[model samples]
Target: MESAAAQVGCLRRTSLSVSDVEGRHREMIVGDRSTWSFRVHYHSGDEIVHMLAGRAMLRIGQSARRVEAGETVVVPAGVVHRFEALDQLGWGFVSEFVAPGAEGPGPAKTESSLIAGVRAMLEDRYSLRTDVAQIADACAMSKGYLSRRFRQESGISLHDFHMLIALHNAKSMLKGGSSIVEAALDAGFYDQAHLTREFVRTYGFTPGVFRAAWQSAPRLPSLTHH
Candidate 1:
């Protein structure tokens, strides 16, 4: 993993797209005065935007709100929202637009070492099955103990976290032009209908509609880290 300073430096030079943290979900690190001005006219999935640094302004329909560091806002599916930088703000932002569930606070600092190990496992191998027993083993704790502690720290069950990861992957594939059936299989969904049902329920529109809107939009220039 890159050092925080290195990550910041990369952002300062240009906008960078990090590896997806979950399925179609991506985290964008935008540097000072790097402005993003585009309207998200249609939404296929809910988006949870967390401000990791500086400040940002979010416009939803007619109303606008400023979000500062350490704050977060959930943009529900189908809402017309746009984001703009506030001043020469550098921001580390996480955008999860594939899942319908909510995330509580992340794991505590005390569990950083363990969380790192788990993250490594997930990043290194997409085939690794995530279960309470497996995660507990990675943390070197009993299943029951890990379950309770993880819930206390993250405010959600371990299973739910894995589900979020799966959903995120599915969304990314969809956005990349993969068929619904293919994305569903790739994301571990039972079938295309299962994926479609959950996706529509969380995002307020069918997958077909979302895909059409996304494909019709103007493509922004590719952003990369130096």
Candidate 2:
């Protein structure tokens, strides 16, 4: 189990893998792409991507690494996953498995007051930038306390929640054929590059790559945000 990217070494074209996926229960899916990437989304169960050719940057959550021909990237159940083709053409055999009791979007979360306020700011007024200190001061608490409590209650940091909201809306706009600049500005990003940077950081692909992929692929799953 070496680093997949390290093993890839470079984004050069390779022979497509013709090996068959071993299971029958999971539906076999075959596909290829160039200058494209899957939308940032998660499944109810684990997903296995067995690379057939070329290389890709596979992002699970915020970290990404490369997977080349003959490599396999397995995304844990319920984890956000995406990948960008890094070579002329990358294809793969994909099997997504829905595990038992994976129904719904997990258990309900009881929102604490701190989490509620932050959620309101991030989800309700996502277009405006809200300072962490301002939230802290309003609650008569230190920023440190606010952030820690927010994370504990929400299972995510305040900054990430805000970023997710922006990214989510930007994605919606992009899928609707909005230009990158329009999506960025409307989603509260300073510019297209800002959205691209955050998108790559979170989704492992640039906005252009995502748009290209979205045009060809049918609707994919996304987070069930509040």
Candidate 3:
């Protein structure tokens, strides 16, 4: 897949990129105590999170659980959950959405209605596996039409868009201190190797080096509410 920087339709963010994963709809969140933390939200699929460093609390269902570094937490789909850092030291983790039995079609051709619908579908059920044919079916269009319109309108193929989303989320997770493997899974990539390839392709830097630089840099401004 082409890197986000190489794609004309790719959306750009700060070095610590964060965005919705297109196909599998997974999202990687990087939260710090000094800056900001994650907000309460629920996904259509299961959410798996692994803490990389520091301390925090996860509100799942009706109970609150303490989550420390090196710990992993899983929340079933549709369960309301929120995360907060425990101290000024802040915390970092990687999260991914997974739906074992959910069903959905892929996205559509490149017009406003088709693209909007495709975007909504991706956002709603990104954790589930899908294909271009399925998405075109959902859009009531042919795969060829979907491909042409999408490429013409977005300046990138549908598949590339999905990869872009995954890379963006992975970068955010890496910045948040997640290991290469953790970020890979969280961002819907195949594995660490896959993430490395995408990372280097998207940002022209390896994940390991990016993490090192981020760890040594000044802390990000806290976004947590008072």
Candidate 4:
């Protein structure tokens, strides 16, 4: 990789790749960008990118490496990185992603006390009818500050995390033969309709469909909570 920003050009393209494993697939990303810069971010899987043209400033952790045509870079899962295209010719890259393992740890415990306390509270009691404002008040922090800090440190908004907890519990109850309405109430939702909406939005299907499908399939592995 080379770092010559002035010479970089914007590029746009697409690519496709197939996975070797049956029923598994990998997406191919081929693009040329003369003017492109991405914020620092991370992926859940490992990625290998082959530079086809021009150059790019690839930041992995705190180091920036210049990659020119014919070179390749491998980024491991969970490592933060960013890309800056260099040259008017832009740079073309083809990437392949590798899936990472399941059952990773939860958010680090070294964040602020407010964040840790909120996390613990949610883990222990998300099934109760509690909202963000109440949680913030209990933690002696403003609602706005709590929301911002939670997202910045945990990579998920406070509301979404609560929904996730609810959904996890609901799924467990469903597997135990609880009715949708009963599971929804026990999981802190207002009613069956509320549960159906979030369930469909998140899982792309309704709870009834899921239960029927699950009955025909092998039991899923136990869910690991943080």
What are the lDDT scores of the predictions, listed in order? 0.53, 0.58, 0.57, 0.60
Candidate 1 has an lDDT of 0.53
Give the lDDT of residue 134 in candidate 2: 78
Better of 1 and 3 by lDDT: 3
lDDT of 3 by residue, 70-134 (tens): 99988765444567778688776666543223342222222367556766666444342547898
Give stretches of model 4 more than 4 Å off. Answer: 1-116, 126-129, 219-226
In candidate 1, what are the lDDT values of residues 65-115, reduced to their tens digit? Answer: 998878988876534456777766444465544422244112223345554
Which RMSD values do the candidates have, in order? 15.1, 10.4, 15.7, 12.0
lDDT of 4 by residue, 140-200 (tens): 8898988887776655567666676677678657756688888888888888878876765
Worst 10 residues of 4 by lDDT: 1-10
TM-score on alpha carbons, each prediction: 0.48, 0.50, 0.46, 0.46
Off by over 4 Å in 2: 1-113, 126-128, 137-140, 154-156, 217-226
Could you say which candidate leads in lDDT?
A: 4
Expressed as tens digits, the lDDT of each residue in 91-172 for candidate 2 is 4444434322314222223335666566566666646476889778878889999888766655456777677668867866
**How well does candidate 2 match the true structure in TM-score terms?**
0.50
Error of 4 at 120 (Å): 2.4
Error of 3 at 68 (Å): 50
* lDDT-superior candidate, 1 or 2: 2
